[model samples]
Target: MRTGVPLRQESLVTPLRLPSLIGCALSLALAAGAAFAQTGTPALPPADEREPIRLLVGLPPGSGVDRISRVFAEALSQRLFRPVNVENRTGARGNVAGEELARSTPDGNTLGVVTATTMILNRHLSRQMGYDPQADLTPISRFASLPLLVLGGPGQGVRTIGELIEVLKARPSTCGTPGAGTAQHLALELLIRSVGARCDFVHFRGIAGALPELLDGGVQVYVEAAVIGLPLVREGRVRLLAVTSRVRSALLPETPTVAETVAGYEAETWLALMGPRGLADSVLVKLEAAAIAVARDAAVVRRLRALSAEPIGGTRTELAATIRAQDSIWGPVARAAGVTAD
Candidate 1:
């Protein structure tokens, strides 16, 4: 049996508990090998294809997104019969890597995981961008939904949303988030505004950067992502006050939703597979198939859910619709918060 611990560089589906996915992929690989050995079949990886594909990540190495991308890339290499390499560009809240993907050759050789925040919300939040997200990229598929949380700092004793609100109303508090225009920032702002509480937001380049302040009481609360925050909560370093999803998280069923206290407040974010605009339909189709298959890999789903990221192996059409749908939700939030690129 596989370990159920998914994601490594070379082979993600193996050593993980995804029997069906591994069996199917191995069958396809074996069948392709046999086709070339016995009869006059077209074979699996076409004779003419040999170039490696590159996946651009907009975060530092070892970040959850980077690790997640490597998992998908390794699996895709198997399906496409090409080496898939992950490259980290890391800056501008993912815009740095996004620009690289936008400018890369679109002949299926280059693709990227553009955070949904960068694609949908940056249009309103960033005053200076190197490229237009919609015009510069082609949708492949959406693979994950990262849930956000309202985390209370140590010594606060603000264990619930109501207690947190009482403290917010009693005195000005500092709220921290990874970046200025991130879903966490907006969601944190929404919570304060909705509860009629007062707080000033402190923006850091990443959640790790703000951890010291939060633990020291310099920052009272933080909008943390479950991928990284769950470990902190489990370690007793921080308290999870509430989940920012519209509904309570399955991982913490007893935890209340921020919406339950304030109403209509959600700040969920996600990542999607994309290639530069003008990509050939054939290449897009191949990428889409590989991404969807890897996302639905039973092991990937289990590991992701454990981290509070719901796996969604949606199609290109679905991703495009999501792009269209998010403008209405986050645009107003960004405007109301008066957030802009820093």
Candidate 2:
């Protein structure tokens, strides 16, 4: 420790030694570059390119929407070669997340997964929506759809749509839905209007609270997503009479569509990928590819179907059309039902 030993032969910054030092540094850099080329390793990404992609979700973790959003996020993380994170920004039935997504920078790194409710019904029901869904958001893809089921527990008398409608028309009955202005609630209203039947509609915070009421015959019939309704049907807690989709659900192949009886009736809630408007077209195309890939992945399709959702993985145009279709259906139903967030 006491010895003053010289570490280098050249003076630290002599003009004569500087060129040699520079030459050595250049040689080393070139060598490193050549090694990287030979090894097929990518050069380090620029600072912005290394940033993680944030995938905002409009629901809480462990909820069906959040779980499905995570599945897409994982697949996208692999496809995009970036960390795609799922952040649960839950409130106002998804508006909280929608508004935030609309305000985020128009980079592919920031995107959102939202349901039909946020895109269509919320705009009609809530006066305080912070952003215009149509104007402020750029559609990417429609990934998953949940076909609702018209369910009745074994304790109820009816088993088919015809029988239920006949009973409902003959005598006023009580029906249940997840909430006042949900897709399930609108479907119920549409059914009532379509069939010229009357039922005192009961709304719950979620289907979980309403399930016990349905089983006990407190409510004659209930409308719920297949993800929640199918398990109850399999357990004999509820009977699946009809599906609310243009076609019958694959999970319940024999079941008739609501449209079969009430011609032109269909209401399916779907999840879509979107970014704030002004996102580059290149970014949208790249994201669309990842979405289509996930939709076509057999394993991913199986997992989504297991969760009672059908995989769509459709183009941005399909998502826009789906949103517009919901506007045609749910907006009218909500108005007829006298529903408003206020």
Candidate 3:
């Protein structure tokens, strides 16, 4: 009787355990499927079958755009199992590179890392822009957004936005920008207009040329990408008065935002992946997938954060919407400010 009872119990438990094992396996398979759906599979050709990928950058090497482009290029090379190279095509406030990208073969081999200035502002500021951002380029994804830092040089005696305003009211001040129609210049113009302060803008060919002027008081204030200005601020060479973002930066929580001081003032630059118009849908899918993957990566997020940039990943539709929205906001502002590149 005891042996019969034990066999009956074993039979019942075995039946339940088999079902439990099967359920666990199914759950794991479903989880994997969900993950794959979110990230999407790599759609580009295998390394052996594909040509080397070129990432075209509009800014000089060591600029914020160039740095971010190289980071993404490295991450993409690993993820796509292909050799990725960064080509600096610096000129025309990023228009030279934009034209090159617009003329490239749309076979997934050429991609451009562009900013708001490259895609939206340049066209509004210059009539002779060689390529139409909306028509000549296909946005793959917007990968990051960088806030601008309003920095005061040594001997400026102004450590806060309020003090800067006071100084401007008392005497005219000059702000250094990287270029005439660049985002930095636009941001400075917006700030001046918002506060009704008196300031002149000095355009430099690049930030490297602008920094020395900033340090020596050739320029009283400089508005530049945080990635480029934060290091100098940290070294005690410059004072960070405010960031141009609507909110304070995570990397500089103690620093205030321009909007906090001057109502309705907010400006930030963004980076996007784009290809020449007429790119194959297949190529776009693969490039977008890789961009989204890199933008979502933990290491990439950490690196961008270190540079005071916010990582943003989204679809082509979303990127296009961003471009359109920025154009709508900045176009009128540029025209109002008489900001023409040529």
Candidate 4:
């Protein structure tokens, strides 16, 4: 989202400062980088000695996740004393990039910034996936948590979740999802199942492509990231029926959570950093420290807040546990709904 400097070689060493506390912590990251580099083979270059760290996103260039990841990547590179390069390896509902990351060397040089689909939903939806998310990846940290918004075009008669339910019950309505195995798709499926509402689902390559249908009334509803839906809602081009987060979104506090209507109904999309499985413990520790530092930076917090995202930084163990819990909770629901890879 920012285009300033071309990410100079010195900027990596130049501190990416936050307001106050963040600056102090990132100084520690610089110290750690120095210490970590020295403790290892001096012949082995500084973390900056390697080419830019490749941060892969499984989605295409213009996707919300891609845009957000690029912002963080740019910021983190400036903070972590290394160039951060973001690449889009798009295909297979993000399975292609997941597979590539899972297969990449575990040197902490190649990391993946992917959504919940690469780690959780894909596992539930397909058994023939090429890589094992848990077995083949090392969780670095999570930087953002995004809620899903239910959107409708004008004349849909769906001013509220209640009205949306009424409209769907009166006639079979169609909802569009970004991809077949995405949190957007599954969240809609969960809602339909919980409310016992019969509706059809339309799968688009991604949210940008799907929004057109909602704008034109080609689809009655869309479940997508708030970052994408907020602008439309603000423009009066679309109506936000509800947010799937249990709590009201900071971006649209006026909109109630779907959980308010259907208790126990909540879902969200998350973006996290992960590396190839078997990443060295030392390298993993350094990478995790860098990620934690980035997420806690005041500037990072401000940027994510603008997008209605909450920053979360934790140990790899915590991320793994989260993935496990999510998998357990959604597996049966996905199966019962007959969700599968497209």
Which has the greatest lDDT? 2
Off by over 4 Å in 4: 1-51, 169-171, 204-219
Candidate 1 structure quality by residue, lDDT tens digits, 65-109: 887777778877877788999999989888998899999987888
Runs of candidate 2 with Cα error greater than 4 angstroms are 1-47
**What is the lDDT of every predicted structure here?**
0.84, 0.88, 0.85, 0.82
**Tens digit per residue, CA lDDT, model 4, 106-171:** 777899997787788788788789888888888888888888888888666668897887777778
- Cα-based TM-score, every candidate: 0.79, 0.85, 0.78, 0.78
Q: Indicate the residue-level lDDT of 233 in model 2.
A: 81
lDDT tens digits, residues 1-342, model 3?
445544343444444578898999999999888887999874556655467888999999997678888888899888777888999998888899899999998788888998898888888888998779789999999998998998887776788988887877677888888877778888888887777778887888766787778778879888888888888888888888999988888788999998898887789999999999999887788889989999999999998887678888888999998888878888887987787887
**How much lDDT does candidate 3 score?**
0.85
In model 1, the Cα lDDT at residue 41 comes to 52
Residue 28 C-alpha lDDT in model 2 = 97
Clashing pairs in 3: none
Query: Candidate 1, after superposition: displacement of residue 194 in Å?
Result: 2.8
